[model samples]
Every structure is written in structure tokens, then in C-alpha cells.
Target: MTIIATLIVLGVLIFVHELGHFMAARSVGIRVDRFSIGLGPRVWGFRRGDTEYVLSAIPLGGYVKMGGMDDQVMERIEGGAVAEEEDGAAGEGKVQPGRGSADASRTEAVPSAAGRRRDSDFDSKPVWARAWVISAGVIMNMIFAFFAYTAVAAGWGSAQADTTRLGQVVVSFLPEGTEELEGVPEGAHFTRIGDRAVEHWGEVREAILDAPAGPLTFQWDNPRGEITVPMPADAEERRRVVMGLRYWVEPELIFVEPGAPAHRAGVRAGDVVVAVAGERVHLWSQVQDLIRASPGREMEVVVARNGEELSFSVTPSSVDGITPDGEPQTIGQIGVQAQNPPITYTRVAPLEAVQVGWSETVFVTGFILNFLGDLVTGQVSTRNLGSIVTIGEASGQAAAEGLPVFLSFMALFSINLAILNLLPIPILDGGHLVFLGIEAIRGRPVSAEQRMRWSQVGFFILLGIMALALGNDFLRLFGL
Candidate 1:
């Protein structure tokens, strides 16, 4: 299932990216020789007109081959002839087919004008046109991500911003040497903390922040039942009294993986999980633990939706997991996530949805840029880098969760693809843009030998990055 999901996700993203190039080439009158969705030997393909659309064996990346793009190949494509493109030319020229000897002689008598290059050749296009062609792929990916995000937001509705209900309980160590409480489970609602009535998470936060320094009593409604915990008396410990607890907007269904137990049982987004196996729950962690502990066992689930309660019986699925002790273990998984619920949620108008989607895209774009900067500056670890394997695992997990989650993942991947391709490194779209920029400034293209040398360098750099990412994937998967 993970493999399938990964392929689908990657295929869609790669296809959209390549399609952008193909369309731009056609629109700009450049002849595209090949439109491929993968690398390496051709697995399957078909030709249409002048272009061969191929599905290659290596599913890592794809490319669009355009006429006159490769100088060596272009020589053969042009029948051992290279047309001298006239400077400042914009439009395409007509091809005179099947010229007779007499016609050839007559054509030779008329002097060729500057800017009279083949319409279908890549180099014959104006610099701006070429720039657009190189950038089209990134543009398409961004556009695709925006629409996808918009659809997801519109369909699921935005998280209500003013929601005050508790969504999760963050259980952590209270300070050392403090009163050790027992049986304090996560997924509890904060009804009150030290006799301060809590209507919203903000109130809870304020109360915790301003409480007098002393042993404090924390009150919350646990899934099993209502419980109260005595906090540590130490001043520092009292200041951090709410470390193990978190108040959220509302308890809502945030994730449902496709083909997972929850998905199979018809669990969906917007459905508020109220109980697991008849036990009332407030935190997503409680639901996660319950599912994780019940491999292959059917459990009753109750969710609230639109003021109505619905029930489902879900059997947890077996999946590979690692224990805290670094031992391989088979854990039960229902393919759901309850943590990170939105502070507020509500429906949006179509225009609002579009606005939100665009904003999200912009935000993600900035995030990727910042992440890249951090990576280069060593502020972030190389271990954070990932490969196709990582993508596959994540995509598969998201697919199991459900469409909304999967689509959201797809959007993120698309943004990643775009940003990565736009990096100003050799052998990438950004590299080509840099070369073109130099050409525009110098009034001529870089020598083929120079381009070739830089391309090789880029290839080595890319190989190193890929290797590092692969190593990270292996380490992560094996708990090494």
C-alpha cells in the first residue's frame, strides 16, 4: 500500500512538472522531442506526432527534451547543419520543404536576414521566451499545490479559530523530586485547574501562568473518568505546572489514513472522536494508545458530528513499529492522528478558500526557503534530508489515513519539488536559468564545454545529496 501511494503521489507531481515544460514549449513554438515521466531505460511509451511520451523504469525524476537544446544531438537532428539565428528575433519562420535544385539556387541568390532561425528550435526563441519555458515547471507545480490545498480546505472546512474545547493532553514529566502521580493518562479535558473555571484554552494558560507558587491541584476529565493530580511544591516546578497538559480549541478528527483501520471503519475528518471501546476520550494521544495496544482486536468507536453521535467498530491493523527500547515490535495501528488539532475551525466562502490556499502556498514556499537556508548554514542537520524512500513511506502512511491527508501531503510534496528544482545548482532548472541569465547578459550562450563541465559538477553534488538522504532513510527505518 505504501509503495502504491508513493508511486501515485510522485507520478502526479512529476507529471504535472513535466507537463508545464511541454505546454510552454508548444506554446512558444519550440519542438519537444520527448516527454518522459521517469529516467533510465524506457519501460513503456507511445509517440504522438513529433514527441515520444515515455514511462521510464527509474521513477525518480523526469525531463522534457526539446529541439536544439543539446548541441551535439541538435547537429544530427538538423542533418549536420546548424542554422544561424538572427539576433533580436521573436516569431517563428516558415520551413520550405522539398526544395528543388532550381528553387535552392534561387533561395541562395537571396541573402538570409538576421533572426531567420528555425521556429521549432529551442535556441531560436527569444531569451524571455526561453526563461518562461525553463520556469514553467515550477509555476505549474505551485499552481497545482494551491488548487489542491484550496480544495482540501474548502471540503474539510477551516479549523475554527475561537474553539475553546480541549483537543489534547500533553503528558510529560512534571519536575524531578516532585509528588509522583499515578494513572494520569493523556486525552483529558481541562474543566478546571485549582478551582479556576476554564471555558477556553487561553483561560487555562493564563491560570497556569499566574498561579501562586505552591502545591497545585490540576483538574481534568480523562477518558476513563474525571481525575485530579497534585502538582509539585517547588517554585520552578509550580511555574511549569502545565507542562503535562495542553488545552485546545475542540476535540476533532484530524487524520484518517486510507486503508487503515479507522479509514476502513469509515472514520473521517470533522468527526469528533468521543470514545474508544466505550471509554470517553478527550485527547488524541489516548485514542492513539488505545488503537496501538489493540492489534487485530475490534474496538467500538463513538464520534460526534453535527450534534449527532455515530458509532463504528474498527479492528486495528498490524504494522511494524519500534519500541522505546529500540527493539522491533509489531504494533496495532488504526491509521489515525488526533494531535495538533486547530485552535479554531469554520467554513469559508469560495473566495476565502482560494485566498487561504494561496496564503498557505506562500507560507510553505517561505518555509522551504528558510529550511534550505538553515540546511546550508548548518543550523539544521543533514539527517533531516530525505530521499524518495522517505517520500514513499510518508505518502503511503498519508494514503492510508485518507484523501484529505493524502492531498495535503501531495501539496507539500509539490511545493518541495518546485523549490528543490529552483535551487541554483547545476543540472537543475535553476542551473539552466543561471546559464540563460549569463547568456542574456553576455549576448551569447555559454560554450558547450563550459556547460558540460558545470553539468558534471552538478551531477556529482546531486549524487552526494541523494546518498546522504538514502542513508538517513535507512537509519530512520531501521532505528539505527
Candidate 2:
């Protein structure tokens, strides 16, 4: 299931990206030769007009072969026959969009003679035209994301976190044994977080949720001192474990995820938590601790559905996770979020959804850019780097949840794909843009030698990143 979901997701994103380039090229009169899906020798395809549309050996990404372009690095990346073009144009490889041979027996031609650069050739086009061709993929990905987000918003409504309301500020989590927190009560108010005066939950997300994983100090008035605790890097765990803001929290079940232990045990949203394992519980922290302590153990959960209390048996599932120590360990999971005192999910009109979608698109773009900057500046750990394995796992999980959730995940991933391609590294869409920019400013292209040298550097950098991400994935998989 994971593999299938991953493939489908990747295939859709890749197709949209490459299709952008293909359409842009044709619009600018650039004759495409080979339209290959994947990155190796032609597996199957048919010729149409001047392009030969074929499926290739590798099933990762697609490419198009355009006239008057020499992609040595791409050819090197793809290897073998994919590098050899029909017009003796060797080293003309595309990453996910490239060219091909036309049928001479029919009536179509290559759009020009094989020996000379034609007016329809990509190199013969204006700088703006070439730029359009190169950047179309990224643009399309962003557009796809926008539409997907808008659809989700229209269908399921946007999930706006309640930032103003305060509940269980300290009871959600209390660092026991810390000298400063020794006298602090369970429901004590927190005045500050990381030098920021947090009057509400908004600032908490910025100070703790958005901050990189590390030892962070907290001060409560009751204790009148500070205690340092390690924080998780991921957002999901940070909400539940670090902040204790789970739904069904506040002693009321606001959300009960389908197929989760709680839901399977017949728990539903709006159920007031009465007890767990027959032990009376009021604080979400106590509930979390109880559930965490009883991994894979069947226990009774009591909730107030109406005027009377109801009980159901649920067994917590154990999964690999981390704590403040950063060491991998088994922890119990019930798959739920919090329900505050009150909650609502109001579906928006199409127009409002569009506005919401645009806002989300811009916000996500900025957030990803900021995160990358942090990564470059060493504010975030490299251990957060993930590979295809992590994405596949997430794909499967999201799909299992439901369609709207799956689309939401896909939208986020598509935006990520677009942004990553805009990085100024060679061989990527961003790198080509850099080349074009240099050409436009200097009135000449960067010499092939220089381009090749930088491309090699870029390729190695990508290889290193891939290795690191794969390593992290394996470590997580094996509970390292």
C-alpha cells in the first residue's frame, strides 16, 4: 500500500512538472524531439508531429529532448542511450523534461535540417522565452498546489487552530524533579517562552513548536525558576507530547481519529473524558502519561456521552519514537488530537476558499524558505533530512486517513517540490535560471567548460544530500 501510494503521488507530481515544460516549449516554437517518461532507454512510445513520446527504463521522472540544448550533466545522470539523440545531438539529456526522432516514412520532419540550428530551436529563442520554458514546471506545481488547497478548503473547511483560548497550560506537561518546577502546580500559567511573553497559544507555536529541536528552558511563577527540557523537531509530536495539546484533551474529546485505538474502542468526538483504565482522570497530561505507560495493554476508557458515563476497552499501539534525550525508543500512540472547550469546522464558499488557498500557498512558500535558510545557517539539525522512504510512509498514513487528508498532504508535498527546484544549484530548474540570468546580464552565456565544472559540483552536492537523507530514513526504520 505504501509503495503504491508513493508511486502514484510521485507520478502525478512529476507529470505535472514535466508537462509544464513541454507546453511552454511548444508555445515558444521550440521543436521537441523526444518526450520520454522516466530517464533511460525508450521502453515504449509513439511519434506525433515532431516529438516521439516514449516511456523510459527508469520510472522516477520524465523528460523532453529540445533542440539546441546540450545537457551533459543530465546525460551523465541518465546514462546510456538516453544521452544519444537522433540528430547526433549527444549529451542532450533532460531531468524530467527533454526531445526525439520524428517519423520520416509518414510526413513529419525534425522541423529543420539536422546540421543547422533552426528558428524553432530552443537556443534560437529569446531569453524570456527560454526562461519561460525552464521555469514553467515550478509554476505549474505551485498552481496545482493552489487548486488542491482550494478544493480541500471548499470540501472540508480550513482547520484554524485556536490560539487565543488557553487550557491546561501547565497540566498538559510538567517537568517533574526539576528544582525550579518543584513547587509548580499542575494548572499554573506560563508567562514566557524563550524570551517571548506568550499571552496565548500563537506565541507558544513560534517559541516552541516552530523552534528547532533543542534544550529549551521554561519558567513558571509557582516554581519561580526555570527548567530546561529537550524538544522534538517534528510538528506532530511537538503538539501532542511537547505541548500536551491533544484533542479529547480538556477532559473532552473534540476529535477521535477513525481507525485509531480510541475510535476503534467506540470513542467519538464530543465525548467527555471521565477515566482511563478505570482510573479517574481530569488532566490531559495524566491521560497521556497513562496511555504512554500502558503500550499495547488493553485498558478501560470511560467517557461521558450524555447524562451517563460509558466505558470501552482500548489497547495502545507501541511505535518507535524519541524523548528529550534524542534516543530512539518504543512509545504508545492512540492517534488523536485535542478537543478544547468548544470547536467548529465551517465550510467556506468557493470564493472564500480561493482566498484561503492563496493565503496558504504564500504562507507555506515563506515557511519552507525560512526553514531552508535555517538549515543552511545551522539552526536546525541535519537529522531532520528525510528520504523517499519517509515520504512513502507518510503517503500511506495520509491515504489511510481519508481523501481530503490525502489531498492536503499532496498539496503540501507539491509545494515542497516546486520550492526545492528553485534552489540555485546547477542541473535543477533554478540552476538553468541562474545561467539564463547571467547570460542576460553579461550579454553572453557561461562557457560550456564553466557550466560543466559547476554542474559536476552540483551533482556531487545532490548525491551527498541523497545519501544523508537515506541514512536518516534507515536509522529511523531500524529504531536507531
Candidate 3:
């Protein structure tokens, strides 16, 4: 299931990206010789008109072969026989006569514009036309993400944090470093900040930040909770506090992976974990800590199910990982999910749904960009980088949840694909655009030797990044 879902998601995204390039080239009258969905030896294909459509063996990436593009070196990586594209126009330019499809295609060769140097060749096109062809792939990916998000919002509604209570008031997905938000008492929620009643954290932050630099009295729901906060005078500190606040999750199982140790031990979803190894646990973190400390050790687990206590003995799987400070370590996992703070779903009209979709797209785009920046600057851990392995795991988990969940994952992954391709690395759409920019300024394209030199450098950089990501995946899953 995981492999199937990962392939489907990647296949759809890659197809949309390559199709954008193909369409833009065609609209500009650039002759495309081949359209392929993967890189490597051709597994299957058929020629029609001037184009040979192929399904290649390697599924990591794909390409469109255009006339006048000197890609002999690229052929090594793309699975195109060296100089095959140049010979595409020499012979067999027409589809063979057939019963069902002969009428759908031209039976004769397409007329050449002139001996080899045709105006329809990619090199003959102006810089602007070439730029459009290069950029269209990223544009198409972003457009797909927007539509997917809108469809999910309109059909299944948007799910957002319902922070009306104390337990569900986490503000950030992951908090930042060198930051501590003290004096956040548990089991206490803000009844009012100043004279206004506050249910959301946004309201609480606004009231606190807008006030003068002084202690602010906060009214709480509990009788002994009229605590005063010595609000930070620094504006950035005020913002950081708002983002750092979070509550521990409840010790309830929301999911149990089929065939996992927990499931095999008769542990099921909706079970409220009460104790582990004879130690009482109230919060999800505590339950996880106990489990993580006992890898491959049979331990007693007590859960409250339907007002009756149940006991089960389960051993956790151990995997290698890095701690927050970058120390190598091994952690135990049982393939169970704790209930994340509850969410509320609301229906929206067509126009409202469109707005919601666009907003989500923008928000996710910014979030991804920020995380990438942090990862490079060492604010985020390198261990977090993932490859196809992690993606397969996530895809399977989402598929198990439901269609809406899967679609959300698809939308997010689409945006990620678009942004990654736009990085100013060689062999990517952004790299081609950079070359085109130089061509436009110099009134000529870069020499083929220079292009090849830079392209090889870009290829190595990408290879290194992929190796790191795959290593992280092995650490997370197989402890290799």
C-alpha cells in the first residue's frame, strides 16, 4: 500500500511538471522529439507523429527532448541513446498504419522547415520563449497544488485547531531554540486578557503585545489562577512566546498500525493508556518516554477501555536516531499514534472555499520556505531530511486515515516538489532559467563546454543531498 501510494503521488506530480514544459514548447512552435515519464532504459513506448512517448525504468525524474537541444551528455542520465534525438527527424517520423489509430495520426513524414536548421528548432526560439518553457514546469506544480487544496476544502471541508479548551492550545507545530515560555500553568485557560474574554491564543498574544511594557494580569478559569505575566518588552520576544506555547497531548491511542507490535498484542485504537511498566502516566509524553526506554523488553501496559482496565505486554521496535543536541541514539517505537489536539471542520461556499484554498497554499509555501532556510542555517536538524523511504511511510499512513487526509498530503507534496525544482541548482528548471538569463544579456547562449561543466557540478550536488536524505531515512526506519 505504501509503495503504491508513493508511486501514484510522485507519478502524478512528475507528469504534470513535464507536461507543462511540453505544452509551453509546443505553443512556441519548438519541435519536441520525445516525451518521457522516467529516466533510464525504456520499458515501453510508441511513436506517433514527431514524438515518441516512453515509460522509462527509473521513476525518479523525467524530461522532454526538443530539437536543436544538444543533450548528448544528458542522454547518459536520461536513458536516451547518444545522438538519438538528432536522428529523430532523419527517418520514421510518421506512425505506422494501424486499424484503430492510423486515422488519428499522420501517415507521412512532417515537412521539414529546411535542412536541419529549422525555425521550429528550440535553439532558433527567442530567449523569452525559452524562458517560458523552462519556468512552466514549476508554475504547473503550483497550480496543481492550488486546485487540489481547493477541491479538498470544498469537498471535505478544512480542518483547523479547535482551541476552545486548555488541552488543545498548542500554537506551533515545532517550537524554536533558545526559547522557554515559563509560567504556563496546566489545567488553566485564559478566561480573559484584560476585559475581553479570550478563547484563542491569537487573542491572548494581541492583548499581551499591545500593552505597555509592564506586568499584565491574566484571569484564568480556575479559582487560584489570577497570575501576572511579566511580559517581555522586546517585540520579537513577545512573538516568540506566542509561537512557543504548547500543551502536552493526552495519553490516548488514535491509531495502531496493522500488524505492528501494539496491534499484535491486542492493543487497539480509542484505548486511553493509563500506566506503563507499573508506572502511572497521565500525559502522552510520559507514556512514550516509558516505552522508548524499554526497547525489545516485554513490559506491562494498562489502558482504560469502556470503563474497564485492560493489560497487555508488548515489545517496541528500536531504531537509530539523533537526539536534539546531535548525539547518536536509539529510540523505541510501537507504531501507535496519540490524539493530536482536536480540530473542527467547517463547510464553506464556493467563493469562500477558493479563498480558503489560496490562503492555505500561501501559508504552506511560506512555511516550507522558512523551514528550508532554517535547515541550511543549522536552526533545524539535518536528521530531519527525508527521502523516498519517509515519503512512502507518510503516504501509507495518510491513505490509512482517509481520502481527505491523503489529498492534503498530496497538495503539500506538490508544493514541495515545485519549490525544490526552483532551487538555483544545475539540471533543474531554475538552472535553465539562469542560463537563459545570461544568454539574453550576452545576445548568445553559453558555450556547450561551459554548460556541461556547470551541469556536472549541479548533478553532484544533487547526488550528495539525495545520499544524505536516504541515510536519514535508514536511520529512522531500519537503524542502519
Locate the minimum summed-lDDT window of 10 residues in model 2.
101-110
Rank the models by lDDT, top first.
Answer: 3, 2, 1
lDDT top scorer: 3
lDDT of 2 by residue, 261-305 (tens): 887778888887779887898866667778887878888989888
Better of 1 and 3 by TM-score: 3
Residue 280 of model 2 has an lDDT of 96
Pairs clashing within candidate 3? none
TM-score of each: 0.59, 0.63, 0.70
- Is candidate 1 or 2 superior in lDDT? 2
Best by TM-score: 3
Off by over 4 Å in 1: 71-117, 159-346
lDDT of 1 by residue, 13-122 (tens): 99999899889889989776667787655578787787767786668777776655442212221222111235533222211221111100000111112424456767
**Candidate 2, lDDT over the whole model:** 0.68
Q: Which stretches of candidate 2 lie over 4 Å from their true place?
A: 82-113, 159-167, 170-345
Clashes of each: 15, 20, 0
